[model samples]
Target: MSKSELDEIINRSLELRKKYHELELTHHGSHWSVEEDALAFLTDAGLVGRNIMSQQERWPKAHSASELEHKIGESIWWLIVLADRSGMDVKAALENFLSKTEKLLDQ
Candidate 1:
């Protein structure tokens, strides 16, 4: 995809998440506590990993496939927002991480 398309996707993702937060407030009547949200996302990541593993099995059904995809997408959104909040460039962070991993493997 073009850079502009990627940017649009990111922007839309952020907007959708903001709406989700609003809905949560409307129903749950409270903002997600930071610690709770972190723990919940971590738990979700673990579940996604399990879903991926199941899909790798010799015989697997597409159970909750869309939900799994949505969760993974949402997890990415969470990471992007977290990085932004922390004043870090997500692209730069990924590049630095990959560079370090490559150097380490070459050692």
Candidate 2:
């Protein structure tokens, strides 16, 4: 995907995150802490791993393709949210990471 497309996705995720925080505040009187967000992301990440294992037939519990796809998308959304909560621009961070990895591999 183009950089603009990726940035758009990140922006949308951030927008949704703001709405979610509003809900959290209404229901619980505060937004989740960054650590809580990290934990939630980790939980989804674990589900993604489980889904992959199921796809490989290594896991006893079976997960549908849709479930795996949803989890993967959710994990990515969490990454964007995490980056924002940590006061970083997700797009810049992603570009920096990719560039550094490419340069290192080229060496």
Please report, in order, the local distance difference test score of every candidate based on alpha carbons.
0.74, 0.95
Pairs that clash in candidate 2: none
Q: What overall lDDT, based on C-alpha atoms, would model 1 receive against the true structure?
A: 0.74
Per residue, candidate 1 scores C-alpha lDDT tens digits across 1-107 of 77688678767766876787798899999866666567777877877786776667623656577877987987887776666556787768877999999999999
Model 2 TM = 0.92
**Model 2, 2-71: lDDT tens per residue?**
8889879988999999999999999999999999999999999999999999999999997699999999
Question: Candidate 1 has which clashing residue pairs, if any?
Answer: none
Please state the error at residue 42 of candidate 2 in Å.
0.7
> Could you give me the TM-score of model 1 versus the true structure?
0.70
Candidate 1 — which residues are off by over 4 angstroms?
58-64
10 residues in a row with least lDDT, candidate 1: 54-63
TM-score of each candidate? 0.70, 0.92
Most accurate candidate by lDDT:
2
lDDT of 2 at 57: 95
